[model samples]
Each structure stands twice: as C-alpha cells, then as structure tokens.
Target: MEDSNGSGRGPTVQDVAARAGVSISAVSRAFTPGASISKKTKERVFDAANALGYTPNLVARSLATHRSGIVGLVMGDIRNPYYPEVVDALSRRLATHGFRTMLTTVWGDITVDDVAPSLVQSRVDGAIIASIADADRLGELLYKNGAAVMLFNRSAATSDKLSSVRCENVEGGRSVANYLLDKGFSRLAYIAGVEHIYTTQEREAGFVGRLMERGVQLFAREHGDYTYKGGFDAALRLATADTRPEAIFCANDITAIGAIDGVRAAGLRVPEDISIVGFDDIELASWPPYGLTTVRQDKAALIESCVDVLVEQIRSGQRTRHIQLVPVSIVERTSVR
Candidate 1:
C-alpha cells in the first residue's frame, strides 16, 4: 500500500491508520458517531488525523447510511436586506444542531416547478422554502418524495402539508394606519409592492380596513413593485399632483427610504411636510439619515421556529404541520409624526 494519501490527495483510511499505528478498522471506528472503540485508541487516531489535517468524507459515510445530513434551503430575493438576515440566522442555528444547509435560489416569486428539481436531485432530507404559494403541484411533489418542508416568512396557505413561520403583516398595517390617523393626518396614500405577494395583500387590506373604520379614504394609490425605483417614481407622481397626500404608507422600508428621497427631491421635508411610514425594521431603516418609522419582525425568532420544525421532522421522521404566525411591533422614529 502507498505510504499515505495526504491533504490535497484526500486523507484516505490507509493514511490515517499508517500515521496512528492502528488497523484500518480502528480509524473507521474512531470517525463513526457511536461505534465501540477504546478511549486510548480513539485519541491516537484523532491525534493522527489532526496532524495529517484529515477531514472525514461525509459522502462515503452518507452512502453507508443512505441519508445525507443536509437540509435544503430554497430562497430568493437576496436583494432584499430582510431575506439575508433570515438566511444568516437559519444558517447559524442549523449549524448548532449538527445539520448542514444547502441553498437553492429562486428568482422573483417562487414556484414549485422552478425549485423542486434542484432540491429533489440534491436529496435533501428536508427543505425550507422562504417564499411559497398555495399548496400547489410543487408542494405535492415534495411531499410524495418524503421530504419534509418548512415555509419561511409566508402565510398559512399550504399549512395542511407543511410547517410555516411568518409575521403578522395585516396587524402591522393596521397599527401604522392608526398611528397616522392619531397623529391627525387626513390626506394619505398607499404605495403597494408586487400585487400577488401575500405580504403586500394582507398589509394593504389591514391598512384600508382600518382607514374605512375611521371614515377616511386614501387620497391616491401607486404600485411600487416592492422596489426602490418604483417607490421613487411613485412619490414623484404623488408630489407633482395638484393635491399631494400629507402622508404615505409604504409596503417595505426600502421603498419608504426611496419615497423619502423622492419627496425631498420634490421640495418637501419628511414628517415636516409629508410623513412616511414603512414595514420591516431593517438595519438601514434606523440610519440617522433615514430614521424610518416601521414595523419590526424578529428574524432570530422566525429562524428558530422554522429550524425547530424542520429539524424535528428530519431527525425523527415525525410530521409537524404547524403554521406559526409571529407578531410584529411598530418602531417609532423621525420618519413619522
């Protein structure tokens, strides 16, 4: 046998045994999670492995067990700051629980058709989809294959088949509307994002419903496509109009920031001339320059809840069909009066 298959060549079992002065089986036993091995032998093998800079081959071990210790994460909208926070929290928490994450990016609104193949081919024991729609064909396919799924930052549309963790968007919307109304602003407008997303729908509904209760109506409406540029242009149109709204409620903080700039460009001061409110208290929302008043969602709690459900199913083969709706709170700042 060759002397050793060192570092770059891949640390083979033979190399480990040669360095440790043990049989090939002893090296294998040392790496196995619960295999029976004497403490002295195990220590020697591990010490040799450390000296040789050997990383055990999880793939070969996975082949023996027919299960890869990886969970797939299907997410997109990386452009949004909120989504990255979600990914970071999940990655860190999952690592602590001894599971690896595989990310599969989905552009725009997620569709099962677009994301399913990559996840299935990767053979992930379980998956967490950050953006999912109604329990469609894609949901069915993933279930049929025995891969447990968890939905992140989405509502309970597909709760029958999957675990979901999301924030209370409607409640946040209602609170903002009330805040604006209490501050005594009568002329108000709404800047909506992509119409199809549930977050936008629920938020708009809550705001409108609250306004209707107060016997007031929004002065105007613009579709912001959940984008900075969209909000900027929409703000310009609102500002240039003969009757500009006294306040605007944007679907997200990014749009709210853009609306602020747009209003300033239109020769108006935030909260001084036209108050603005936003949702999702992202890092930038609190910047001295922006100081946007918005709704806050706990990213850490969302990830903990999502990972708890996913790991429960993956490890024990028990199905947990839960739809967890986390609460949101309003964070007051200079943007709103």
Candidate 2:
C-alpha cells in the first residue's frame, strides 16, 4: 500500500498514535464520542488527525457501537410552509438526542423506491418519512434492510405495521365546518390539497361529510396541491360558479392566502361575499397581509414524539411502533367572520 506522498506505507492507527504521543486506544477513544479519554490526549489526537487529513470511518464505528447515529428525514412538497416548520423541528429535536438528520425532498415524479434506496446507500441509522401517503411498500424495503422507520403526518393502512405521529385532521376539519356553519355560512366550498394525501383526504372527508349532514351543500370542490397557485386557480373556479359559496375551507394556510387574493380579484369582500378558513396555521397565516383563520397542528409535540420513537427503535434494534395523534385547534382571525 502507498500513502498519498508515494511513501511505501499506508497511514494506520500506529501512525496517529506515534504523532499524538499516545496509545492506539487513546487515539480511537478521542475520535469516538461517548468513549473515555483525557482532554489533553483528545486534543493531541485531533490535531494529529487534522494534520494527516484522516477522516474517522463510520463503518468501523458502526461495527463497534451497532449504531450509525444518523437519521434520514424524507419530506415532500417543501413549498408548503407547514412542512418546512415540521422539518426544522424534527431536525432540531433529533440533534439534541445526538442524531444527525439526512434530508431528502421527494418531488417532481420521484418514486418511493428511489428515496429509500438512496438513504440506505448512505447508511442512515433510521428514517423518518414526513409526508409519503403511500409508504406501506416503502416501509418493507427499509425494514428488510434493518433500518428503523417512522412516519410523520402520514400513516400506513396495514394495521400495527408501522409507527406514526400525526395531527387529528378529522377533528380539525369537523371543527372548521361547524364553526363556518354556525357563522351562518349556508353555501360552502372546499379547496382540497392533493387528493392522494392521507391527511388531506381525512380533512376533506370530515369537512364535507359534516356539512352534508347539516343540509349545507358544498357548491364546489377543487384540488389545490397545498400550494398558492393551485389554490389561486381553484379559487377563480369556485368564485365564477352561479350561486357561489358563502365561505371556503382551504386545506392549508398558503392556499388560503392565495384563495383570499383570488376572491378579492373577482370583486368579493372576505366574510362579506365569502369567508375563508384554512388548515395548518403556518407562521405566515398570522402575518399582517393575510391574517388567515386556520387550524394549528401542535408542531413541537409532534416533532418531539417522532424523534423519541425513532431513537427508541434505533437503540433497541427493534421497531417501537405506536400511533400518536396530536391535537389540533382552530385559530380565529380576520379571514373569517
């Protein structure tokens, strides 16, 4: 073996030991977190490591610890304000528990197989998928590969097969529907997110089902993809219909803002010509430009629970499967009467 300098030797633990004036075990301990070594010895070892440009190999660490100390975070549709907040919270909380986050955004025709395969290649200790509605099949691959897996804001249809943390989307939708109807919104419309998302489907089902029971017909239903443009376009369609709805329930705050603009462009005053209610009370929802009335998902508690479950699975070498439902509450603001 040849070193980078063409010396007739490859760098070894002995080389680091000699340079640091320490035993080989001391050098190893310095590089390994939670391993015991004197501070002075650790500093010397690190300095030698820097001089040699030698990166600690995690493969060896994994062999010794039976852990990778890395967490894969799979998120979709980052354009939605709600997701970024979720990602931030998840990453921060995971870091506190000594786990690093590997972020992957599945967008623009990306498949489930593509995402899990890539993360597996990187040898992430475990994975937390935040928004894959069709995650049942993907869960199989990760489990087979011995990767601890957890779902966030999404659930597997296969009972007790996967772990997940999500909000009470149905309750939120029902609350919004009842609130709007009680405000005397006789005619209502729904601006739904992607039809395939489990959370969106549940919210839509609850909102529309509750309204129908009250004999309040939904004048229109359109898909928003949880985006501003999708909501804007859907808004125009809802407003142009004969005998338009008196209020609109958007799937998320970003869409709600766009819907408000779309309604105003068509010469309608919010809550006068139409009232608007949205889910996912993102930060921007309370901004001056759009004081949107929305449903708040408990971001902190959701993220904490997700990280805790993932760590348990990772450390125990087994799945700690549980279904956690975080509560959601409505935030009333100027967008609705």
The lDDT per prediction is 0.81, 0.82
**Collision count for each candidate, in order:** 0, 1
Let me know the TM-score candidate 1 reaches against the reference structure: 0.85
Tell me which residue pairs clash in candidate 1: none
TM-score of each: 0.85, 0.85
On the 0 to 100 scale, the lDDT of residue 15 in model 1 is 82
lDDT score at residue 122, model 1, on the 0-100 scale: 69
lDDT of 2 by residue, 59-128 (tens): 8877887667788888878988888888888888887676788988877798786787787777777888
- Cα lDDT tens digits for candidate 1, 159-211: 46767788888898899889999999999999997776778889999998999
Q: List the residue pairs that clash in candidate 2.
A: 271-274
Count of clashing pairs, candidate 2: 1
